[model samples]
Target chain A: MAQEFIQWLSHPGLNHFLIISGILFSFGIFAVLTRRNAILVLMGIELILNAANINFIAFSRYGTGTLDGQVIAIFVIILAAAEAAIALAIVLNIYQNFNTVNVDELNQLRD
Target chain B: MDLFTIVFYFLAIITLGAGAVVVFSRNIIHAAFALLFAFFGVAGLYVLLMADFIAITQLMIYVGGILVLVLFGVMLTSQVLDVQMKSGTIQTFPAVLVVSALAGTLVGIFWSTPWKTTAAAPMEVTAAKIGEMLLTSYLLPFEIASVVLLAALIGAALIARREKNA
Candidate 1:
């Protein structure tokens, strides 16, 4: 059993990549849920996007063996860039208008 | 272990450890810097997976372009940079519980499923193939991505510019 597990670790299969992506996704969610700063939240979103990208690349390499997944990943990266740009712009705007970047404290909109 | 396996393990550690720092670090600057390693590690993983073109693109667009913009955002929004920009966490316990459940479920699904895999050999060169596809089948998306980037550029500039009279 021990040698089998060691061999599996060395092989680094699809499940390995998927598990790592899962862990990354969990960390991203934790950051999004726990961080009050809007910029930090945006960072969390970036992490989530990256986790998904890893899965795409891994699947392309292992499962499909086509460039389709990589192509989709490229588009996803482009979207993430645009997202980070626009989201940060919005965060800066919030800071300018409200003098704070805390998502929780930006509650005047609710009222 | 063979060299490839060792390299894979190294890249995975770098990726996950740096990602951890990015999420858990209190100082914003530290987190941002740590993210550099995370991105680099991901790029290395792409290379190991034989997505050479995507790996280079990741390095250029992420490590070069996006990271620089993110640093600019950090500096521009914070006003003062001398003090530690300590961003605090909230609802930590509940977040832990929720994230644990989510991760467990995902890993369970990943392990239990019988994923279909092909034995196609990795290409020696992916850049030319990717380029051909981009100009051929992915032509519309290629153009659309450029347009989206242009719009984002204009919108970001408009929003972030200093309004002297507002």
Candidate 2:
């Protein structure tokens, strides 16, 4: 069993990348679910986006011979940037309206 | 282990460790700094995947542009540095339980599924091919993405701007 595990570690196949992406994705989810700050939540969203990008690049390299996954990853990156800009602007607005940046305190819309 | 495997392990550790810091750090400034390492590590992983162009783009756009903007946002906010910068979480136990369950399910699916794999081919310069595809096959998406970016820039500026009289 020990030798088998060593061999698995040395190969560094698709499953390894998948596992890394999975862990990153879960961490992002945890941050988004639990964090009170809006900006921190945005960072978690970025983490989720990066995890998806990793999965895309890994599959593109290992699975199909085409560059479709890479192309989609590029698009995803572009969208992520745009999303971050708009989200941060909204967060700034939130801060301006309320004295705090905490999501829990922004309960005025909780009708 | 071979050099490729060794490098992969190192990059994975850096990326995941930085990500943990980003998620769990108390100070927002420290989390932003940790995010820089996480983005850098992801760019390194991009190199390992042979997506050289995407790797460079990730470094340039993510590390250079968005992270700086995020840091500015964190610093410019009032009282961010003095006090109330604590990024506390509510219901941490439940969140961890849910996240762990989801991660386990994802890992199981990843290992059990039969992914289609092909032999590793010789590395070729992918930037030119990606550029060509952006122009030809994905021309519409390419143009649309630029337009979206333009709109986002304008919208963000408008939203964040303050009234002169106020």
Q: Local distance difference test, per candidate? A: 0.86, 0.90
Residue range B1-166, candidate 2, lDDT tens digits: 7889989999999999999999999989889999999999999998999999999999988999889889877876648447777778888999989999999999888777888899876798999999999999999999999999999999999988854336
**Fraction of true contacts reproduced, model 2?**
0.76
Write down the TM-score of model 1's second chain.
0.93
Q: Which stretches of candidate 1 lie over 4 Å from their true place?
A: A109-111, B79-84, B162-165
Question: Model 1 misses residue B40 by how many Å?
Answer: 0.5
For A15-104, candidate 1 gives per-residue lDDT tens digits of 888888888888889889999888788778888988999999999999988898899899999999899898888888778888788888
Q: Write the per-residue lDDT of candidate 1 for residues B63-131, one digit (tens) a residue.
A: 888888788778777756457488888999999999999989998998779899777474679888888
Docking class of 2: medium
Model 1 residue A84 lDDT score = 89
Question: For each candidate, what TM-score against the reference?
Answer: 0.95, 0.96
- Candidate 1 chain A — worst ten consecutive residues by lDDT sum? A102-111
B79 Cα displacement, candidate 2 (Å): 1.0
DockQ comparisons of all candidates to the true complex: 0.72, 0.77
